[model samples]
Target: MMCFCASAKNNDIIDVTRIQHYDTILKKLLYFIDYSKKYTIDDINDTLFSYTANTSPFNQKKLDANYFIKLTLANTGQQDSFLLYTGKAQRYKMYMCDSTGKKILLKNQVTKFSPGLFTNIPYAQIALKKGEQKVFYIALEINFYNWYLFDPVILRTADHAYFSFLHLLQPSRIYMAITIFFMGIMFCMFAYTFALFIRNPLWEYLHYSVAIFIFMVYFGLRLLNIFHFGSLYFLFYDLRYQGLQLLGHMLILLFILSFLKTKEKMPAFHKQVKALIYLQLIFLVVNLPLTYTNTYNYAANIAFDIMRVLGLLYSIYVSIYLIAKNKKKEARYLGAGSLLSIFMACLALYVDRWGNFDELLLRYSGISVLIFMAGVMSQMTLFLLALSYRLRMQEANRIRAVEQLQLENDRKELEKYKAIIDARDSERTRISQEIHDDIGSGLTSIRLLSEIAKVKNSESDKKELEKISATSNVLMDKMNEIIWTLNSRNDTLLNLITYLRHQIVEFFEPSNIILEINLPENVHDAPLSGNVRRNIILSVKEALHNIVKHSQASLVSVNFSFDKVFIISIKDNGVGFLHDKITDHTNGLRNMKERLTSIGGSCSISSNGGTNIELIIPLNTYPV
Candidate 1:
């Protein structure tokens, strides 16, 4: 709305005609330093006021002191009112004087004037007629804590000033819009990372989310500082820049530590980063006191600048180490992102420091701020990628572990099956050998006796034929015993007991020995292997045969019971034999002992007035 190309000389009289619509009058004004803070309008004289060639006349000055400025205006055009604006100040007083140096208008304790919508500045309105001149005196005070490096004073026609303020707001509005967009993206990333932390409970996700939150708070305050929002103006301005920067750097350091698992993977580097973080915190705490007291402010700022640069460089170096030395896939993305962010951050800092050469560059090209935001966004995106990659790798490792465990189980199962098959083959070979040795020899003897009987046909031959009939019956009984042992269905302890009871009843029926059976009502019916069952049955049969042939017992008792083992006791009231007198030819006792031992069982024989044979079968020795 207003042009800013107008120029004026450093003279006491500012010709209003040369001021097209709006122009800075900083160079045309005379200034005086008030070290004692006792200066009044009456104390100000032409001799005390001095002109400076510096564009920013207040630069590098102590903000605690009062500054007095004088401007004289001459109206060479028609009658008009103009606005005298100071860009920013804590407080100021304006005095309007005539050519005689007598005050005509006095405004006391003026803080700010809003000449246009969204534009609030310290200003004074001066009225001038054709061929009229006025001298204005301004006493400016600045707060030490809220000092600016440059202060501009501008003069413009009232109507033009209003429109010029609107024109100046255009770039700020664009920048604010972009900032809001960036904040939105940051908020989304914060929510995403926070959600991830909630799900996985990993330190990296939590640290990243907190860092994003800090970034949001810093940027939000920055937005408030830019807009100079009503009540929070001082609060936003005070915390917007250096203090938040220190806090953000600390948070970023924490995020880096967690994201890289530095404590576990890089212990030495972890300690170095931790010390750097502590130093940043120390600087932040020290900076507050120095800034508030306006003591050592420049030195503190310089120190903070150096620390920030070093911290950023160290972070970049760590990222490079992870990428190159550690050879982490995720680190490559992180390193690339960090490099881009650091480069953009340095570029933004450079632009901010030097772009002050042009007022438009300082006001309109918020490109520096945008570039810095782009850097943050890029870093955040790559960090998310790194996190995703890490999670995927962890999931893949879990799956592989599960597959390995399953493979181990399958291998064990295959070995178990092989053992079972080998045991079955050994049992079959033993059965075949027994059939060949026992049954084959007996059948050959019967065939030879039948042939001899057919040739002789005498009484002796007939008697031999009857012997052949008895031998056939014993062979049939032995064949039935082998078949029963081979049957898998009889591989239970209950089945073995049932078959033994039937045989004991039949054996005693032909003898005068009274057999009394005692068996438990409740049997566990535990499983027994074929080898175990066959050995147990054969041992019991041998004991019974011994009882019948030699014991000469009038009464016999068989008792079956179970505890941790199966127990079978056979007691007889008979003429018991002495173990010392029994010869080595007593093969029945030796065979029974050997058979029981093969199945992890034991047999014991004891004699007092009678003989008792006991068989102990350990249940756990066989399948249960």
Candidate 2:
């Protein structure tokens, strides 16, 4: 009975045959020993049979026999051909052990491996004589890539235990693990950026999409064995990979184009870029069936590779164009990142092709993806920051301009008001001068005439003297009233209204028109400018005079209130004339309007059942 077993390394071994002979033992081993350091193979020779040593350096202590070793023998002088098998291309050697255990090599055969078939290699093998024990060690020579293939070797015991264990712990397995870890991190980063972009759909959203797709594709391919979903097994190998690749390329291109404003510089180039991206998509769709059919896979692969290269070129072109045309910092960042990713991808693939650093290349595929994502993220951040900065600046400038315009308008309006006030003051001075000159001369002459008549002492002369004196006194009072109206200082709406009410009451005491006052009783005495107060008082006096003069009705009402508008309305139930005829060309009505306007107040007069003149003003603004 034979036993079958497995180890922690997951090596499968079946102990069925005690003695086994293999015409050739071929093994393709990949090891993690530093490629920079070389391990030695010992070619031992025994005294019972002399053997030749291989020309390479001999350091048996460095040789890991369990990691790689095989035994094979054939007639040394006759059959120089043996069947060889290896997964990939590598270098190998043959060594013979003599009776004294001094191993020697018959030949060193280094050859390239063609995948999937057995081929013949011409190399001399050792021949064993009767009653003599012959030993031979055929092993792979480690190179810079740490990959090697073995020739056919005969073993007394055929066991797959060691090989399977080494395979389980291969560098590829570590690479796969590392790839998964970084890919997870990349996926997280992409998701984070995507979420931010969704919150704010800035231009960097394009990069987020491309980065997510790249990581998803890579992660999906890596976790293939876990899902074990058939038909989707070779998703990366199918047209979906190419489709995603093209999509990523198009997104990057669009981002660059939009970022640099490239269309402004070269409109024709933009069209070409669009067409090329579209063609790339079309080809990806066209090649799907070809990729699925085994007979056409090679052709599809070639086409896909070509498309990838072209896409790379297109990206490079856009980047270079942006750098050359715009020369902006954002464009530079985008270009630099794009070029770096493309270069890394190509360099990794090239190293794999050169049969060097296979493990490093696989490991760096994930790293390259990470670098690419980081670059894209950096570019996105820069763009978003720039856009935000620009928008903020624009908003600030717009606000500043609006404020400046408002200030200028206010300044111009102030100047206009000043000019109007200056002109009005000049006119007032002229009118005051006329009142003082003409009226004072008339009164003086009348006073002199009255004195002469009084001196005459006749009855008629006395009456004449008294009449002249009364006329002079009336003129004097009129001058005083004019002076008071001109004395704008200390004038206020409240003071003016109080003075007008007093004058009306006194004037009407001897007449039939009974006047009343109703005003804002609780208003604080906030100061009002002289011109505003004078205008309001004069307007109110004129309205009252017109009511007493024109309206025949006896009952009259004067009301004042503070509401949404500060209002003063004077109404009289009299035989009111047509308001339109009065307002049409009436100097009094026009003067009233001018006075109200000077103080930013408005006045309206209407006579329906009664004559009503209402003046409305805004408090703290219109004159007060």
Candidate 3:
């Protein structure tokens, strides 16, 4: 929206006053004036200053103190409704009186400047000269109406025109009623929500405290219908209405900061917020003694304007920071609400400063509605933000409950697997002990008998006996290995690693292939469940067996390392077979991957120059 400008033929005055001296003149003129006092153009007599092309002073010869200035004002906005009544001789009555005084129009001996209903054009201007220097008190009343039931009148001087309106009873009452009733609802809602912040009772009290002051300000404005309380009602000794407005705004700022959890989001902003409130309170204390002192007002108002802009700018900065840092919904709500309120307030201040709204129809009402609506919008936005926060908390609780249920189910499944593994280990231990004591001993005895028979026999028989001894010895060794496989103590990670190292070296002792073993540091005495150790051992053994049997490798290396996860690599300088065929086998690679997966690990084989097998198992999966 653009700034409203006063349209006047004195273009030089309009330019200088509208741009530079506008706010200064308006503030000076308005601050000391009693807003409730009725006034006419004569009250601002212009006979002392003359309007001429050369801008000279008024000619004293034309001045007459006894004569009253006459001013005829017409609605420049819309004149079709009043055209018929124009150019007709008619009598008009005008008056000025406060809320308690008798009607001054009825007591007038003879009203000066009462031009008969326009027997000429729609507008007329007459200068009045009163002998006294004191400001005249009068009203400019126009006996005119529109379909909308507004009594539009205009106050006129030699230089400018202004409109006066009879205030609407319905729209004013409706807004006041809505504001009061909903404000009550807001209080209760705030109380309920505020109890949540009572852990820090200052915040709770701050919300309630601010709400009380705002309630009073709204109520006071509403009561203007019955009481002729002036605009500076709060600045007076017994009734400081502006103080209420100040307190209300300060509380609102506090409530928003606390509501959005800003203390945690931006600690420095929280400190500044406290300091600002304290500073406003100090200003209030100082203002109390200087209530009637006008000497410092110029500096004070300027300071006030500066602080308002800076404080609001600080709030905006904090909001941007919150949105960027946390991306929170509440921050967005507070930010948008604050911006709307500040903009409307600034616009209203501008209008009151330089707007000639008295010359227009329904414009002041539009501005009033904008201010009221801004408040309503801010309140509603904050309410929804609080509601949304409550909903999110409920959703989080539901998700946590679901996660807890899933964890319990997983625990039961883990216990089932553990029980089965323990039973299988016990059975394997019994079978391994039986084979080592019974079957291996029998094989050893049979081999010794065959060896003794060789000395008693002839050449051919002796050769056959020696062959039987060699066959029996080989059978005993195979049986011993089978027994150890059934009942082994290499169930922990440390024991399994040691056993695997010995077995690999022993298996390749008679072979021509060069074998290398690389064991990682910190591998010994690691915490591992028996089942996980068994799986790792089986997979490693299977891979080595494949290398020995199928792979025509000259050199082989096994390496292990572990941290968050354990890794083992078995590489061989052998002609690698196609991966598709190797992976499809039931006896070797496929079985190895199955064993690795059963223990929650993964296996992959890759080859460029030779074969490289990699196994990765989570250290956390091994019961650490």
| Residue pairs with backbone atoms closer than 3 Å in model 1 (clashes) | none
Runs of candidate 2 with Cα error greater than 4 angstroms are 1-233, 258-265, 295-299, 327-364, 385-390, 393-624
Model 2 Cα RMSD, 1 decimal: 17.8
Compare candidates 1 and 2 on TM-score and give the better one.
1
Residue 481, model 1: lDDT of 80
> Each prediction's Cα lDDT score?
0.73, 0.55, 0.53
Structural similarity to truth (TM-score) of each candidate = 0.59, 0.41, 0.37
TM-score of 3: 0.37
Q: Quote model 2's TM-score.
A: 0.41
Q: Best candidate per lDDT, number? A: 1
Error of 1 at 22 (Å): 3.2
What local lDDT score does residue 460 receive in model 1, on the 0 to 100 scale? Answer: 64
lDDT of 2 at 4: 17
Off by over 4 Å in 3: 1-171, 174-192, 195-240, 256-265, 292-306, 324-326, 359-366, 369-376, 379-387, 390-394, 409-624
Q: Each prediction's Cα RMSD?
A: 17.6, 17.8, 15.7
